[model samples]
Target: MQTRETFAGLSDWQVGLWYALVAVSVAIFVWGALRLVLKYRRGRGAFPTDNLFRRVARTAWIVLTHTWIRRRDGVAGLAHALIFYGFVVLFIGTAILAFQDDFAEPVLGWDFWRGPFYLGYSLFLDVFGAGLIVGLLIMATKRARNPARLDYGRVDGVGSRYERWRYTVGDWAFVGSLLFLGVTGFLLEALRIAETDPSFERWAPFGWIAGQGLQAIGVDGETAASAHFGGWWVHGVAALAFVAAIPFTKAVHMLAAPASVATRNDAARNRLVGLPPNPVPEEIGYGVVADLTPAHLLQLDACTKCGKCHVACPAAASGYPLSPRDLVLDLREQAEGTFGVRASLGVEPLFGSDANLLGNPIRPETVWSCMSCMACVEICPVGIEHVPI
Candidate 1:
C-alpha cells in the first residue's frame, strides 16, 4: 500500500469553492422557505389554532413515519420509506463535512472526523448509502416489473401511458443518481483506506470485493491511489449535480416539504370554498380559473407526483373525473404556459365556461371531483394544502 497523507486543511481554492456551494444552496433554500412563510402569513393572517396543530400533527406522523403509506401500499410503501429515510441519514454525512471543511478545521486544531466521530461517521455513510442504493434498485425493478400482481385500475381508477411514463422514467433517473453516488463514494473511500492502511480491506464491507479484484490485477498502489482520487471527484461532482437538480425537478419537494409543513395554516384541511360571489359588493370569481395564485402554483411545485394524492380523492378511486395527481400536473402544465403573462388576464377556466375570462379546459367536474378527504394533504411530505379554498 502507498503511504497515506491526510490534508490537515484545504487550500484557498477548495475553501472558496466550498463556501460558494454553501452560499448558493442556502440562498435557494432560504428563498423557498421565505416564499412559503409569506404565503401562509398572508393567507392565514398569522392566527394560530388548535385545529391547525392537530391537522399538522396528523400529517407529520403520516409523512415522517410513512404509516399511511404502509397501510395502503405494503411492499411498494416500504421501498419508498427506505429511500426517504436513507436520504435523510445520508444528508447528515454532508452536514458533517460542511462543518468540518468550512468552519471547524480553520478554527479548532481538529475537525469532527478525527477518531470516534470518524469511525461512526464512516459506518453511517456505508450503511445509509448501501441502504439507499439497494432500496432504489428495488424500486426500479418494481417500476419495470410491477410484481405486486395488481393493475393500475385496481389501485387507482385508471392509469395512462403518459402517467406511467411520467412516473417510471424520471424515477429511474433519480434512483440511478443515488446508486451512482453510493457506488462511487464507497469506492473512493476504499481507495483512500487502501493507500493509508493495507488492512483497511477488512473493514470496508461494501467495496472490498471490487478492491480485491483490482488488487488481483497487480495494479500498483500508486495507480490504485489515482483511481481512488478519481472516484472521489466523480462522487463529488455527481452529488453537486444532484443538489442543483433538486430545485428544478420533483426533487424540489425535498426542500419544499419541510417549509410547507412548518408554515401550514388553520384552514388548510377544510375544503377551499370556490371563489366567493358578492352580488351587491365589488368582486366575484370562481376557484382557480385561468391564473393560479402563487400559493396554488407553489402547491404544484411542492407535489411529489407520487400518486399518493390520487388515493385521497374518492372520485379518482371510484372512476369519476378526478385524480389529484393529474389535477396538479395540469395546474403545473398550464402555469408553465402562462408563466410570463401578467396576472391581470383574469382567472382562467378550470372547467367548461366560455363566457368567463378565467375559465380553461380544466373541467368543472374535475374541480368538483374532490371528496375533500385531505388524503393528498395527509400523505404529502411537503405539507401541500390540497383542499380548495
Candidate 2:
C-alpha cells in the first residue's frame, strides 16, 4: 500500500502541456527515423531479409553481451556495458510507471505498482542510475587520457581545426548529456523524497540518503516540494528532448549499429564481386556514393567514430593520411549533410564533392592509400563492411 503518486502536484493544465510536449517529441522522433529509412532506400540494393530470426538472435546476443566491443578494449567495453544496461533499466522503469499510471490502475483497477514492487523498482533504478554515471565517468577519464585509439586527430585535415574541435566536443557532449540526464534524474527523485519525508521511500536507498542530507541542509518540506515541481519539468523536458534527438545524434548508433549487425552478410564481406560477362561502364563497381548498397549506407551511419579501425589499418600505421575511421566519418558527414536531420537543419557537409565522393574531402591518396587488407573491417566492432564500401 506504499505507492507514489504520478503527476501529484501539477495542475490539469500543466499535465496537458506535458502530454502535448510528449506528443511533439514523439512526432519528431518518428519523423527523423523515417528520414533515415528513406535515406537507406536511396542506396542501390536492399538488405537481405533471409534468416531474419536467426540474424536477429545473433544481433541481440552480440549487442547485448558486448562481445565484439570487449574484444579490443576490456575496460572500455565494461564501461559501455554498464551504460547500456543502466539505460535499459531506467527506460524499462519509466515504461512500467507509465503503464500503471495510464492503464493498469485507472483502466483495469489493478493498482499493483506499490509495496514490494514499487520499492524493488525504486532500488533497482537507483543502483542502475549510479552505474550509468560511473560508466560515463570511466569513458570521460579514458577520453582525458587521450589514448592513441580514441584519438580524434584528423589525418585528412580538411576543415582541420574545426572538424577536430567539433569531433572532440561532440564526443564529450554525448557523454556529458547522458551524465547530466542521469544526475538530474537522481536529484529529482531526491527532491520528491525530501518533500514527503516518508519511511516507505527508504526502499529507494540513494534517494532516501540524499533526501536526508537535503533535510539536514535546511531544505524543509515546502522548499523541497517547490523545487521538485521545477526539477520534474526540467528532467521531463530534457528527457523528451533526448528521445527526439536520438535519430539525429550519435545516439542513432543505438538503432543503426544493431541493424548493421542483423543485416551483416559474411558472403558480402569476404568475396569481391567481379564485373558482368559483358559489362558496360555503368555495370561495373561503385562510381558514386549513390551506388553503395543500402547495407553499406546504413553501415556508414553505424560508425561510432571509435578509432579501432584507424588503429588497425596498416596504412595509418605506415604514416598514411588515410584513417578508415575518418573515411567512414567523412562519408557519414556527407550522408548526414546531404539528407536527413542535418540537411533539414541546413548543416553543410564536410566531405567529398556534392557530385560524387573522392576529392573535396576524401583525397585520392586517402582512397589509394588503403592496403585492401580488410584490417579495418576485421577490427570494426560494428558490422561496417569497410573494404566493400
Top candidate when judged by lDDT against the true structure: 2
Model 2: per-residue Cα lDDT at residue 64: 91
Report lDDT (CA) for all predictions: 0.58, 0.84
* Prediction RMSDs, each to the true structure: 6.1, 2.0
Residues forming the 10-long window of minimal summed lDDT in candidate 1: 349-358
TM-score of model 2 (CA atoms):
0.94
> What is the Cα-based TM-score of model 1?
0.72
Tens-digit per-residue lDDT, 241-336, candidate 2: 999988987888988999998888766456755566997786566666667778888999888888988888898888888888888887777777
Q: Tally clashing residue pairs in candidate 2.
A: 0
Q: TM-score per candidate, in order?
A: 0.72, 0.94
> Could you give candidate 1's per-residue lDDT for residues 289-363 as a string of tens digits?
333344555666666665666665677768787776666666554543343121123444223312232234356
